[model samples]
Target: MGFLMDLIGTLLRVNNLTYRYSSQDRNLLEKVSFTIGLKEKIGIVGPNGSGKSTLIKILVGELTDFEGNIEKPKCDLKIGYLPQDVSRDSDRILLEEVKAALPEVYKVEKNLRVLEKRLENDVDTEVLRDYGELLSKYETIEGFQLEEKIKKALSKLGFTKDDMKRNYNKLSGGEKTRVELAKILLEEPDLLILDEPTNHLDINSLEWLEEYLRRYKGTILVTSHDRYFLNKVVTSILELRDGKSTIYSGNYSFYIYERNLKEKQAWEKYEEQNRKIKKMEREAKRRKIWAKRKEKEKIGAKDKGFITHRAAKLAKRAKAVETRIKQMIEEEKVNKPAVEKQIRVKLETARHSGKIVLDVCELSKSFGDRILFNSLNFTIIRGKTIGIIGPNGSGKTTLIRILLGEIPADSGFIRWRTNIKIGYHAQEQENLNMENTILTEVKRENSDETFVRIVLGCLKFSQKRVYEKIKNISIGERVKVSLAKVLASQPDVLILDEPTNHLDVHVREALENALADYSGTIIVASHDRYLIKKLADEILEINGKETKYFPGSYSELKSKVEL
Candidate 1:
């Protein structure tokens, strides 16, 4: 009976949800609908600007003007939502910030303490009864273990003791996000909604979060571009594409398999319907030709009445076929599924370079008293791809800058092979000129304006978008523009720092493919495990004051090292 009830119970139901901006003619989300059951973990995925965030906002009651009917639980329910950008400010420490999520629990604790103090002095029966009631309530809610829960949640989210002691308002953006996530986890709401929760998390934190979500007792709805994380945490996939929602009854891998099968089936059905319609039209045309020939032959004939009757019958059949065609057009039209755009990237390489492309000897760098790397020695060979992995503040960007000669290393030398031109993609995309248009940015690398336009178009930039200033475009667009410039340079060595940070899955895959096919030496620092595993021939694991090189894929390196 419990199993049956759980299967039938719907925690949330959205009916015919439609939304559109006032300035637009088309709806951003058209007739989207889905349901979530109790404790179901759902992962939402879609391209950028595909209404994933809009749907999340609607679910959280932030957008009430949308055309939809949403049914929620009538009983006592709480909701916790983590938006893509967490900007909540507070002067309290991290522990206090997280504890604030459960104000009722804290309040109960305070009341219990006050009542106990009152009863110590005056043995009033009413006071004693109130204290007993408060104690029972506190125990029922497990309020005694609240502090322990908060500490555990924070530790699991990669927060150190020092972090908990620091003021929340003074933390960095990534730290703030982690603190906000810690608060949400501590809240333990009936429904937990997270948008891109894995954005700023390192590998360790991501693993911890995945495990935590697995054991979470709430219904989870998360939208993330991290495919590996989605596969680990979610039991089902909710794909938002072309203003619609598709629920796949399995994890990320299963969704990919099922989506391919579904698209194939839809295409086949459309083709079959089109064939039938075409055949019907051909038969109708034959009947009309036969009627016209018969009518002409029946003119002034002895059996003119019979011939005319047969001709009229043929004409009537043709008219009926035309009506049927119209009905089919109106009732049986099959819309072809939308295809996502893919970025095309080609990294040009030099014809020949020395066997050793780059060599770093006794490299050391320090900021103030903290040393990022010390005596870091590594060598890169031609036609090799190396992945750099480490924690957030482990100097991946600093190392890349030293290699490019943009920053001076405190002690050591970087030697590059002769005639080896280098292409660099900065993590923050600072290499791009914000004042310049996308077209102008690409034109700087290559003087051919026509080629530049084609390259921009291939990177999924529309003609109108190509003329927009880099500052006005999105981070993803700016990344593409920077990438176009790098590709145009045709360097013998390519160095990228967190290149996959803002790219969607499709574009990331495109980049991976382009790099895999390139003959040049590639070095990239990224937290994207899928990309690292797919491209890296060796792993450069960077820890504080140490660098280790393992000649294998990221998965292999994970087994060998303590990531």
Candidate 2:
């Protein structure tokens, strides 16, 4: 990986790393080599099934039977790894859990207490030395202000003071992830490895994390599908493809540009090689023709021998050229770049809804005393993409459900015009039937098997894949199934809740393009800023106290919020 880039302050080195699952025929990671720098913010990027998770697992010493060497510069190096799935089953409160993040710190603190107690009785040389050494260790680990640091981190990560007192078991999945993340940040490991860390984070928490990571004094190796997050946080990118690592000394945007440039250059070289091969073949054929013509000519009987010799030389030269062409084909040919996998679906909407698609008046909703949103008033026009954004518990889903008439608003007027057919794509893909095959589920959209198959194909579902049950497929494929269903419905107003969740960058880009081309009113409630910015013309920002309308793109809304 350091073939061209500077390798200053390298923290860890991965050399000739290769791994294969027991059931797999081919190695998932093949000779992957990369150098992680000290205090460097680097990102790991690849498409799904590119062995990103496998690589992380190997790096963290989860799978030991892999062929590779991971070199750590420091003997006592500490690493904090955050995987996609986190489960902490504990009865302890938030503060206690975070405080106990580094159990070694507790040991240090306990030793310091004992040393201090001994100082009260014995003031010997050995005792003082031990105490001084322990104190230095404590300070190095930031044990003195540990609690304060934990509290500050918790607050920044959207944890309330009351939440700190709440039981860890009581917290939701996202809340638990936050608590876990805060603990990791507080612990301050020398090397932090984050895998899909932004999956559960809200927009506010994401912003906070970006800033925190920027200021963090630890080396970070993070893998995420969030391009925006990678762009903001990572200084360099390490892209894994075909079990190999390609390094880029810049963020996600730079990586994209470089990757494209490299692919273009590769294509150019391959085409040039093909052109040269064709030219050589043509020249050899022309020489052979010339030799045959010279041999056929019986002019100048005296110079007949000379003509034959000339023909023989020309034939020999042609044969030499043919041999050179064969050697070039065997040795000097450039491999063509593989075609990228991308969904090629077009979402078309029916023009059946009225001019005023939806009108909400004085929408107020509260669970007990906690008001989620109050006095929400807005009118959604036809053929406009509206982005609904809010915090985790700020009623974005509730508002969406209310608009879809799945949930009742406390005091609101949801006026839908005539012929307004609603097509909803839920975040969890609840609309899909787990027991049903993908083909069966998609067939529900269109009874015609031929049409359904075509749609599924466009969504990157092969003929064999269509028969697979929904539960057997990956979350990303399930998302595509949901899209297929939604497309078949052909609703006038399309409502997608966190549509980009669990999607790879390529699929997300495809979805964005389709949604952008959709002429119907698109209402999307998502934490995906990239999707929102690309699609939304206006924003419905639901903060618990007030549901405000920002009549601009997500970037404009962000600027206003910053102001």
**After superposition, which runs of candidate 1 have C-alpha atoms over 4 Å from their true positions?**
1-8, 108-145, 272-330, 341-346, 449-454, 561-563
Location of the lowest summed lDDT over 10 successive residues in candidate 2 = 1-10
lDDT of 1 by residue, 1-563 (tens): 01113544778899999999888889999999899988899999887888988899999988888997999866655788999887778988888788778888878987887888888899999999888888889888888798888888888777778887999889988888888898888877888999899999887788889999999877899998888898899999988887888899989989989988998898898888889889999999999999999999988799999999999999999999989989988998887656645555555684569899888899999999989988888888999999998877788889888888889999989899987888898877877888999998888988878767756666667788888998898988788888878766677988988888888766676667767767899999988888888899999888675778787888887786565
The residue pairs that clash in candidate 2, if any, are none
Give the distance in Å from residue 172's predicted Cα in candidate 1 to where it truly belongs.
2.3
User: Tens digits of per-residue lDDT for model 2 on 1-563?
Assistant: 11112344778899999999999999999999989887789999887889998899998999999897998764467788887887869998888888777787878987888989999997989999999999999998778888787888888787878888999999888788888888777767888999888998888888889999998888899999898899999999998888788899999999989999999898899999989989989999999999999988847566898899999999999999999999998898788887565445455666656778888899899999999988888998998999998878899988888988888999978899886778899888777889999999988877978767766766657789889999999989899999878876777888898888888876677677667667788999988988888889999988676778988999998888689
Total clashes, candidate 1? 0
User: For each candidate, what TM-score against the reference?
Assistant: 0.85, 0.88
